[model samples]
Target: MPQLNCIAPKPEHGSTSDPVEGGLSLTKMSSESQNKAVLAFPVQPKPLQLPLYPITLKFEEVVYKVKSEQEGFCCGGTWGTKEKTILNGITGVVCPGELLAMLGPSGSGKTTLLCALGGRLSGKLSGKITYNGQPFSGSVKRRTGFVAQDDILYPHLTVTEALFFTALLRLPNSLSRNEKLQHVEQVITELGLTRCRNSMIGGPLVRGISGGEKKRVSIAQEMLINPCLLLLDEPTSGLDSTTAQRILTTIKRLASGGRTIITTIHQPSSRLYHMFDKVVLLSEGSPIYNGPASTALDYFSSIGFSTSMIVNPADHLLDLANGISPDFKHPTEQSENMELEQKSLRENLKSSYEKNISARLKAELYNSEINNYSHTKDASIRSNRKAEQWCTSWWHQFRVLLQRGLRERRYEAFNKLRIFQVISVAVLGGLLWWHTPTSHIEDRIALLFFFSVFWGFYPLYNAVFTFPQERTMLIKERTSGMYRLSSYFLARTFGDLPLELALPTAFVFIIYWMGGLKADPVTFILSLLIVLYTVLVAQSLGLAIGAILMDIKQATTLASVTTLVFLIAGGYYVQQIPPFIVWLKYLSYSYYCYKLLLGVQYSEDDYYECSKGVLCRVADFPAVKSMGLNHLWIDVCIMALMLVGYRLVAYMALHRVQLR
Candidate 1:
């Protein structure tokens, strides 16, 4: 038998202290003779570089309140409003070169406090939050990075492309392209994401990187800016223990580099818990404990809550704060009595902390820090001046977003399902109305109407799903101040034009020749142009609906009803649509497209036999005159106006929804 021994640094000080030499031993035995062997592997130490500008975040007496509605069965289910306090007098300070963990049970205001510190909270916050002795401002926000609980990224983009795009939009223009690329590459290596740098970021349907890798990519994105303060929410919520430990290890290394790192964690392993320099134990929106992580157990034990050697320290502290002792081994005690004792213990601990040593020390620290900064002049002006400058110009933002949007749309427009759908519809429609007879006025009119309706229905339905799917990513990016809403909306709307027109162009060319309406090249081209414009109008309408509702199912339902109404009012199903409701036909883009196509095909001299050659009548001119579609150019202009109008409305809707 052979044995191998390896030496590793102790986990306690390994996270924060410099590297030190350790002892090692190894033994190996041979089959025929007694032999021994030893192997040594040395780990070189690399000193972490401190941040250029260090920052310390302190919050005192922070209270957040929200107005919530309560529904009661009284008076047959009436609703009443009430005010609820979420965070009550939370005070803490996170210094540089330390990792702080906010631990609590569910609904304990951990996330709320994190959001408050990150400047992302929307509720009424009354408190004094200062960064290095100055009040929090936009400059503070620009230098701070927040990683949300969920990973919100573009699934279609590869990891390299996603990070590169973010770097372009987020890094300051003063840095050259080579510098930005170098920074991104450095971050990739730091987060251990170099292996998956070129892999696609897949979602539930697609398979790409693992869950832990995706989370790393999310962290790597924020690191590219080299922010002074990094805040993360539940960074290890759904990850395996091994992956979770790796993420925490990376965070610890990042903290050692002099960045103030704060994160909310749930039930971390004992080894993982040792990495934090400080911990804030929260219960029911209140801080139960706020001090050094290593002294937390001692503080609890001193207050009469003792733990056995078998219980994990982190778990014991959470259970005690949450009023449940899962590790209690008393078999004789009733559940009711145990619960009552737990509740009493929690209340006593909360009261003791408020009036005890930790609270007093915190108050003194806050006062001293406040006094230290009161004498400085022009502090805020210097900090905020640089923050106000945008990372890139408006034109640069538009150009980058336009390129990304076009690439995404090109991939989406030619996907298997979408291509099959477009081809299927074109093939089926062509076969259904093959080689129509011009003499049969009824059949010819029906075929032309179908052509208009098909293009309208197909594009509108697919566009309904666009905004909803991207809403989360849009909101996340907007909150980060990466780009403006108008820029994104404009890029998305216009970037889709080339592909939007391509599909319909192919459809109309095939159906126009197959259906054989008017043989003239001018007429064919005119009909194709009319159908193309109508498709754009329909797509714009769909975008508006999606932005307004922001829900796929609801938007789909509304779009369906709108499409049906337009089809009915297209002036083909029932020409005499009861004068009161006939105005709908005027609003229908399909109606205009149909009228234009017919006018292009027929002139004043064109005639049709009414009853098997019994009488040849000039139906085209009469039909055009009665419908008031004699001016084909006017219809074309109206359709174009509708396209632009719908897009404007969609833009407005998206702006309102996103800002709200």
Candidate 2:
């Protein structure tokens, strides 16, 4: 058995060091020398006071099966369901202080294997995975860090702010604020992200950090907790060669510090390939080769798929694993034999590796290591340590999440376009119904109804995008055990309240006086409060739609239809709806808001001259009584309850749908 050793550039006396072009120099050695070198340098960093227990992840006979439904057009798009095997009895071991790269073609279960190892997949999985001889549990999951390929981050937050907030919610409650900040700073330095620490992590619309920097930020975020096992899926998928190499270099350094790293990479450069300590080549969920990366080429050569000096060993191995034979310009002496060899290459490689002596010896060594550590007393201590939750207290989680939510909403909520839209609507409505006379009861009622419709529509429309945009981030964070769904939901709902109220309050203040609806101070105050609560209710509805649908277009369309229904059911429109469907008015915030506004203005004492010649001064038009809106307080209370109800439903939907 061979031990993994970190390969660093050995300084040459005459050679000039060029950081960019002068790549890290490597020296080949025998197994004995490698073992000696491994023992010379400390695997785990001693400076960091945090525990870095060596983790050995062993998976045996792992199998994952998923039942998927395929829609067929024969029976009016009926679903034809079947069980699919994703991982087929795969076996491997990821030792401590090593960098393992899972390589395979598209749909080869690289991501699936990584997910199964990290307990992220949510399907039927059968396997025995042990961390230092113990079964995988919540404690192991807490101590492990998984970074998905997509960088799920808040684009509005600066790098420092993002890391700081993550630390606040993720670190234990025993650590002081300054201690958490120190941990964040250490991670920032370790990942070389200090330069862009203050820059915002922008997205497609807003330019911020570069893609490579964003990936590093993602790694830094996970590194905050200092987990022993770090798993990443396609960490360098979209990065350029240079950037990918740099990221891999950082990963190698981390591995040298005793963290077990398992990353799935696609089409890595030769330089990046050499950085890995081991490689697991999978073709259609079956391992073709799993052993020391340095010896992989020799293994393949011994199995009769020799590679030329010009070809990268990793690429050649992948080609063979994918059942792609090398192009031969000239025909061989026996073309039939050559074709047979090409067809059987993948199976031959898999069979050869399974029967190889080195693989068996490695397995024996792993078994011995597992047995050696299984009976140790450290297991209980590690279990007790794992018993400590990764998150802070419930209230602390709320506070930290609230701060993050408020900061994000403040940056996202008050965009120029939204502010401009609100002001435009206010000014347009004010001009259209300018200086309304109390005697023109129809015009006054129309103006109030328009206000209700505007407030309700704008808030709901904006709130529709909130949950959709944050859905990925929320799921990622929640799966990491950084915070609970309730904390996040409460924080988001309450954090947006001040800003949600601010705009509507200002809009009502400007439009009320301009429209000249009953100028009493009490009427003005009541109208302001009603509009504020109406916007809140609309926002709540938007959140619910967003959470339930998980698609921006779907949520927006549903919200629009819902708002249109409320608008139609509002008291001003079709005041005499049929008795069978009249109950729908109770569901419309617009209806309650319009009824309250009408009640505030048209009291029993107020009288207006009828336009028709048959009747004169019409007193107490009976609009409020006819609609059965006698209790203003009840309308307000119902609106408040609706707000709570929508938010509660949204929370439940989010909790149910988020990744477990």
Clashes of each: 0, 0
lDDT of 2 by residue, 409-451 (tens): 6666687887887788888888888998766677877888887
lDDT per residue for candidate 1 within 2-32, as digits (tens), equals 0111121232322432111111011111222
What lDDT score is found at residue 465 in candidate 2? Answer: 88
Kindly report which residue stretches of model 1 are placed more than 4 angstroms away from their true locations once superposed. 1-51, 325-343, 371-377, 614-626
Model 1, TM vs. native: 0.87
Clashes of 1: 0
lDDT of each: 0.76, 0.77
